[model samples]
Target: MKILLLGQHGQVSRELQLLLSQGHELIVLGREQLDLAETDNLRDAVRRLQPQLIINAAAHTAVDAAESEPEAAFAINATAPGVLAEEAAALDVPLIHYSTDYVFDGSKPTAYHEDDLPNPLGIYGRSKLAGEQAISAVGGKHLILRTSWVYSLHGRNFLLTMQRLLQEREQLSVVADQIGAPTWAGSIAAATVQLIERWQSAQTATWGVYHFTARGETAWFGFAEAIAAQLQAQGKTVAQLTPIATTQYPTPARRPLNSRLDCSRLERDWGVRLPDWHDGLLECLNASR
Candidate 1:
């Protein structure tokens, strides 16, 4: 399959490049080759490439910074996805796009389901929700995957930040109120590849929204402590982790307290479930060595 993937430098995109290259013809593009913010250029590139499948791994992911750059966030997150969906619709090909857990307001007591209503709390969430809506409105064969707390060895992520901070600071305070599963980018890429294979073989693919995340949940503080432990296991000096409330360390953009997603729909339909958060973290840390 000729797959045109957006966002070459992103964490997930980098993983996809490695996983999809095994048996597929993959054409990965960065901002220089295909800018998402520029609709004309993005459309032209998609038309010229005429890929069998379109995968959009690019997104404006600076959560706090997005508060001050609403236009930029929406342009890349919302407008660009819609444009890609439109082009895919025209070509009658399947479009695979990624979304976030921020689409919810964190009011739900339990895990969020695919049918749950979205009530985004910040500019970043709102933009992502808008993108999801736009793709659904475009009425094409698409897969909208909503994941949470994504981290990996490559690129800017929570695990990498924790490693650097543990080396620099003797002690650190992490938010304990905000909770979500830490998903590995490699796992996401691998699962996406599996889904593509299933979609190709099946007579009719299940095309809709689905949540993908590691099993179990943890607050930011717990995640930090886990990272610190991983570093310590590697014979490195680690920081003393301290739990702090969200109010103690406020950001420019508000975050959802409950980012837990119910991924049963994905597992039931596709027979694919990501590994546990701690397991994924350990694998990632091991891979980095």
Candidate 2:
């Protein structure tokens, strides 16, 4: 299969590249080659490449930074997706795209489901939600897979930050109020290939939105503690972890207090299951070591 991936260096993209390259013709375009911000160039690139499958692994992922740059965020996260959907629909090919759990307000006591109404709390969430709407409106064969708290050995993510802080800071204060599963990028990549293989074989999954993530969940403070425990196991001096409330920390954007997403629908339809947050973290760290 000829696969055109829209991101070259993101955590999930990096994993996807490795997984998709085996036994497939994979074409990847980074920002320098095909910027999503440049809508015209993006359309032209997709049409010219004429790939069998289009996977948009690129996104404006700067959550706090996006608060001051709504236009730029929307350009990549909103406008670019709609254009991809249109082009994919024209070619009669399936488009695989990623979304986020931030689309919810995080007020729900339980996990958020695909059928739940979206009420984004900030520009980042709002833009991502808009992108999902655009793709659905275009009426294309697309998989809008929404995930949460993604991390990997590559890229800027929470796990890397915690690893660094556990070594540097004598005491670390992590937000205990906000909670979600720490999903690994490699796991997401593996699940994506399952979707592609099934679709290619005409197994036919219900097309639309789905929430997929690590099975279990935890607060940021708990995640930090997990990192600390691992460091201690390595005979390394770790930080004195302190749990803090959301009010104790402020950011440019408001984060969802509860980012838990239900994956029963995804598993029921696609038969894909993710590891627990702790297991995923261990796998990621083990791979790094």
Candidate 3:
């Protein structure tokens, strides 16, 4: 299959490239090649690639920063996706996009299902939700997979941030109130490829939203503790982590209290299950080592 991938340098995009390149032809574009802010350039790139599948992993992912720069976030996250969907529909290609668990307000006590109503608490979530709406409105063949707490060995994410902090700081405080799965970018990318292949085989409907996240849930503080434990097991000094409430470490944007996503639908549909967060974390850490 011929696949056109945006956000070539992102963690998920890189993993998708690694997985899909083994059996498919992949054309990837970095920020310079196809900037989201420039809709014409993005559309032109898609037209030129003329791929069988268009995977949009590009997004303005700075959650707290989006609170201050909502306009820029919307341009890249919301508006750009609509443009991509329009182009994909015109070209009759399947569009695969990634959304976020932040779309929910995190008020639910249990894992969120695909049918849950979105009530984004901050600008970033609102922007992503807007993108989802735009794609659906276009009546295009698209799959929007929402995931949370994504980490990878090759990107600026929670895992890397925790590792860096442990190296420099003796003690750190992480919010314990916000809970979600610590998903690996590699896992999400692999699932995406599987979904694409399934759709190609006439299994999936080619239009719907699904959840793809790691199994199990943990607060930020607990995730950091797990990282510290892994480092300690590997003969590194473990950092002292302090658990704090979200209000104790206030950011420019508000996050959902529960970002957990139920992956039962994904499993039932694709026959694929996400690994446990600790296992994924260990694999990533070992790879980095």
Candidate 4:
């Protein structure tokens, strides 16, 4: 399969490059080759590549920074995805795009499902929700995967920040109120492969929206503690983890208190399920060494 992956250095993109390269003609494009903000250029590249499958791993992911850059966020997160969807539809190929759990307002007591109403709290979430709507409005064969708290050894994410902070600071305070699965980029990539394999093998693969994230849940403080635990086990002098409320460390962009998304629909429909967050963190940490 000639797969055109839209991101190169992103955490999930890096994992996809490694996983998808085994048996496919993978053509990866960084911002230099094809910038998402450049709508015309993005459309032209997709048309020219004419890949069998289109996987857009690129996104404007700076949550807090997005508040100040709404235009850039919408251009890349909302507009670019719609353009990709239109092109993919023209070619009659499946479009695989990643989304986020931030579409919800976190008022729900339990996990959010595909049918749940979206009430984004900030510019970043609103932009992502707009992107989802755009793709749906385009009416193409597309997979809108809504995951949360994506982290890996690469790129800027919670995992890397915590790892470095834990070693440098003797004391640290982490937000304990915000809860969600700290999904590993590798876990997301592995699940994406399952979705692709099912589609190619003529399996029952329905496209629309699905929550693809790691199992279980943990607050940011718990996630940090987990990272600290692993570092300490490695004979590193880790930071003394301290739990702090969200109000104590406010960000430019508001985040949902609960970002858990129910991924049962994905398992039932595509026969793919991710591992526990703890297990995934361990796997990712082990892989780094």
Candidate 5:
């Protein structure tokens, strides 16, 4: 299968490039090749590529920044996805897009399922939810995956932030109110590849939203502590980690109190189970070294 991936340099896109390169013909484009904000250009690029599969890993992901730049966020996260979906539908190709767990309001005590209603609290989540709606509105064959707490070694993410903090400070305060899976980009990429393979072979009409993330859940403070522990195990001195509530460390945007996602739908459909967060974190840390 020929696949065209947007956001080629992103953490998830880099891993997707690796995973899809082996068995499929993959063409990647960075922002230089195409600007997602330019709707016509994005549509033309997809049409030109004529790929069997279109994976949109591009998004405006700065949660706090989105608060001040709602329009910019909507342009990229909401409008661009709809454009891609419309183009893909016109070309009759399968569209695979990534969303966020922020689409939920975090009112539920348990992990969110695919069927759960979305009640985004901030501009970031609202924009992503709009993207999901756009994809659905296009009436195309699509898979919108919502994942949480994404981190990788290659880009600006939680892992890198934690590493920097570990080096620069002897003590740090992190929020313990938010809980979600710390998913590795590589794992998400691998699962995407598997899903593509299954879809191609089965030729089944599989479409709609699903959740994909590393197994298990942890608070941001706990996640930071784990990272510190892992660094210490690697013979690095760590600091005194302090857990604080969301109110203590206010950001531009209000994050969900709970970000856990239920993976049952993904598992039931694709038979892919992500590794635990700890294992994924270890792999990323090792790779970062």
Candidate 6:
């Protein structure tokens, strides 16, 4: 399989590069090689590579920063995805893209399902939702896998931040109002391979949006507490995690309180589901150590 993967240095992209290195021809591109903000460049790269599959892991992931840079975010997250979808459709190849749980407003008491109507709360969420719509509008063989609270061992994510803070500070406060599954990037990468394999073999495979994340949910504070506990278990002095409300820690962009996504549909259809948040966290922590 010839795979053209975007976002070479991203957490999930890094995992994808490692996982797809064997038994496949992988062409990974970073911002310098392919600036997603420039749709022409993205299209040109795809045209030049002529890959059998396109996996877009790139995104404008600056959540709060997107509030002030909506245009830039839209350019990369929205316009670029539409262009990729169009190019993939023209090439008659499959595209696997990643989205976020921010598409929902988090007002629902229960976990979000794929069928739930999107009601983005901030510029970042709105831009991501726009990208999703743009990709779907192109009518290609695509899979828009939406995940939440992504963290990893080798990235600027919540898990790494907490690890640094626990090492430096005696105590820390984290927002408890916000809730979601802390998905490991490696888990996402592994599941993505499964989807790609199934999609290649299955004569009739459903292609659309699907929520992929860890099996459980927790607030930011709870997640921090888990990190601290793990560090302590590893014989390291950790910080005291203090729970705080969203109001106490406001950001430029509003975040969805309930980012819990229902993954039963994905599991039922593909027989793929990530481990529990704590379990994934342990694996990440162990790998980092």
Q: Estimate each model's TM-score.
A: 0.98, 0.98, 0.96, 0.98, 0.96, 0.97
The better-scoring model by lDDT among 2 and 5 is: 2
- For model 2, residues 43-86, the per-residue Cα lDDT tens digits are 89988999999999999999999999999999999999999999
Which pairs clash inside model 4?
none
Query: Positional deviation of 46 in candidate 1, in angstroms?
Result: 1.0
- Which is the better candidate, 1 or 3, if ranked by lDDT? 1
Q: In terms of lDDT, which candidate is stronger, 1 or 4?
A: 4
Q: Per-residue lDDT for 125-168 in model 4, tens only?
A: 99999999999999878999999999999888899999899999
All-Cα superposition RMSD per candidate: 1.0, 0.8, 1.3, 0.8, 1.3, 1.1
Model 6 segments more than 4 A misplaced: none
Cα shift from native, residue 248, model 2 (Å) = 0.3
Global lDDT of each candidate: 0.93, 0.93, 0.89, 0.94, 0.90, 0.91
- Runs in model 5 lying further than 4 Å from the true structure: 203-205
**Local error of candidate 5 at 98, Å?**
0.2
Q: Candidate 3 on 226-285: residue-level lDDT in tens? A: 988887887988668899999999889999999999999988877767789988887777
| Model 5, residue pairs in steric clash | none
Q: Model 1, residue 69: displacement in angstroms?
A: 1.0
lDDT of 3 at 129: 99
Better candidate by TM-score, 3 or 6? 6
Highest lDDT against the true fold, candidate? 4
* Runs in model 3 lying further than 4 Å from the true structure: none
Write model 1 residue lDDT over 24-67, tens digit each, in one string.
Answer: 89999998787799999999999999999999999999999999
Q: Per-residue CA lDDT of candidate 5, range 1-289, in tens?
A: 7888989788899999877888778888888888899888887888888998899999899899999999999999999999989988988988999999999999999999989899999999999999999999997789999998989988798888998898689889999999999999988988888788788888455689989999998999989999999888879887789999999987889889999999988888778778899999888777766
